[model samples]
Target: MPIEVKNELGKIQVMNEVIATLAGSAALECYGLVGMASRNQFKDGIAELLGRENLRRGVEVRHEKDRTEIDLYIIVSYGTKISVVAQNVQAKVKYVMNEVIGLQVNTVNIFVQGVRVA
Candidate 1:
């Protein structure tokens, strides 16, 4: 479902992909984050890393009446504090969605797919 907003001019619809992109971008900017991870899980239990163009593959957005919830799958650098990285991602995603996209984020959930040495 798209997010609908009405202004003096008319109604605007924000697609899910837009939200996903914003969330993914925000998450990637965090210090410990390596990259976004594709949600598709392999039989060998590995999640593929997604490039910039494929960011939406790592983010899931759900729209409610007044807010949106986001789930982000990411990989972090080895030896970084996982909790701190997750919190940073959550805060950044929430800020971008609210400030840039003008959407209220109800939740930003982070899933750590893997840790890379470099």
Candidate 2:
């Protein structure tokens, strides 16, 4: 589904993939965040880190009513505070989506897929 934004001129529709990529990129910028992780569960129970172009694989975007919801699957650096890092990612994702794309994000949910020493 597309997110619709109405203005005096007309209406703008943002694709769900665009929102997911934006959110994924924003999440990757936060401190202690290693990289975005694919949400697909493997038999080994490990998720591969995703590169920039494939960021959407790790991000899920949905629109409910007038609000946009984002879910991020990420890998964080080992020994970092999970809650603090997650919070920062949430704030940054929300801000970037709102400021850059003119999309107001109602929630940014972070899922810690795994932690790496690096």
Candidate 3:
């Protein structure tokens, strides 16, 4: 379901996929992030890095009542502090969603799927 925003003009709707893509792009701009990881679990499932075109596949967006929650599946660079990377991703996503997109994001959940050496 698309999120509807009410303003003086009328109603504006934003799709969840669009929000996910924006979040993924914002997360990619953060340091120590290698790339996004696919959220699906296949046979012999490993965290496979998703291509730029599949940004929405790596992110899951949930809207409950008036709160929006974003879940990001990511791969971080090896030797980087995992906690710091996660925090940065959280902050960046929140900033882009709330400030840039004018969307109210309640939570950003980061799941480090893997660590890439390069």
Candidate 4:
């Protein structure tokens, strides 16, 4: 009897994990960032238990050959200016993604998903 190994194929490299992680971390680092929470926390927790690599549900990475796009959906702390927070997030995320990941980001889209009370 002989043991044989099969090679896997057709893996679509949609986005770079490092860049995605950096993006998520950067977004969270912004001032007045409450946290990344799912609309349904229970479902999100289950997804994590199932070994989903991208734990931050509201963040997304759209990859291209030469550039990457970032989308961040966030909940701001109550009484914080949404505009200021969003601007900070955009600047920080863009800077980190470009300097650290060495990838050109076409855009950083910030979506104000919700506001959390203190």
**Candidate 1 deviation (Cα RMSD):** 1.3
Model 4 Cα lDDT, one tens digit per residue, 1-118: 1112223653322245556566778888888877554423444333111113444566777755555677877778889999999999999999986676445678998877667776
Residues 21-117, candidate 3: write the lDDT tens digits.
Answer: 9999999999999999999853366688899999999999999999999999999999999999999999999999887678889999999988889
lDDT over C-alpha atoms for residue 34 of model 2: 94
**Which residue pairs clash in candidate 2?**
none
> What TM-score would candidate 4 get against the native?
0.68
Cand. 2 TM to true fold: 0.94
Best model per lDDT:
3
- lDDT per prediction? 0.88, 0.89, 0.92, 0.66
RMSD per candidate (Å) reads 1.3, 1.1, 1.2, 9.5
Model 1: how far is 25 from its true place, Å?
0.9
**How many clashes (backbone atoms < 3 Å, residues ≥3 apart in a chain or on different chains) does model 3 have?**
0
**Worst 10 contiguous positions by lDDT, candidate 1:** 40-49
Q: After superposition, how far is residue 102 of candidate 4 from its true place, in Å?
A: 1.0
lDDT of 2 by residue, 19-114 (tens): 888888888889999999998864488779888889999999987777778989999999999999999999999899989878888888889999
